[model samples]
Target: MGVDRSMWKMNPERLQEHLQLKNRARQIPDKKKESKKRACRVSRRALPLFPSLSV
Candidate 1:
């Protein structure tokens, strides 16, 4: 279960794009975590001002 390197060499630009995509994919989890943290902070701040809306 390995990629064929020869096929990658046929188009360096495509390979570079693929590598960049892979790198971005790896950063997705961290990005999601940061987004969730920001969302939590926002929700917490809003909650205090909207206590009457809560059941």
Candidate 2:
């Protein structure tokens, strides 16, 4: 037996967004990650390694 659309009440826009996000979560990232990389902290001096390149 088919359920009436009105019985299962949810905002149409919210339902669509939820479904889209659910589907998106299943897909793999574009890059095939070998492993998780450790986050490295850089000091201000290191950031401008090449001053000319910064501009």
Candidate 3:
């Protein structure tokens, strides 16, 4: 039987480019990481303004 080249939905070169783009995106830090650092900082700033709540 002949190989079914149409079985591949994407062209091989385009598929490789798409995968590389995905890997590049994975290296960037997203908003969740930034917001987590900001959240931890909130208590430090809040504690100064609300001294009674800090107890």
Q: TM-scores, in order shown?
A: 0.39, 0.34, 0.48
lDDT by residue for model 3 (1-55), tens: 6864654788889878877887899898899999999998996787687679878
Q: Find the candidate with the highest TM-score and give its number.
A: 3
Q: For residue 7, what is the lDDT in candidate 3?
A: 41
Report the poorest 10 consecutive residues by lDDT, candidate 2. 33-42
lDDT head-to-head 1 vs 2, winner? 1
In model 1, the Cα lDDT at residue 34 comes to 90
lDDT by residue for model 1 (1-55), tens: 6976775565888878888887899877887789999999998887667668775
Report the C-alpha displacement of residue 43, candidate 3, in angstroms.
3.1
Model 3 clash count equals: 0
Report the lDDT of model 1 for residue 17.
81
Estimate, for each residue in 1-55, the C-alpha lDDT of model 2 and write its tens digit.
6754763576888778767886797675544342332123335445667889878
Model 3 C-alpha lDDT versus the unseen true structure: 0.81
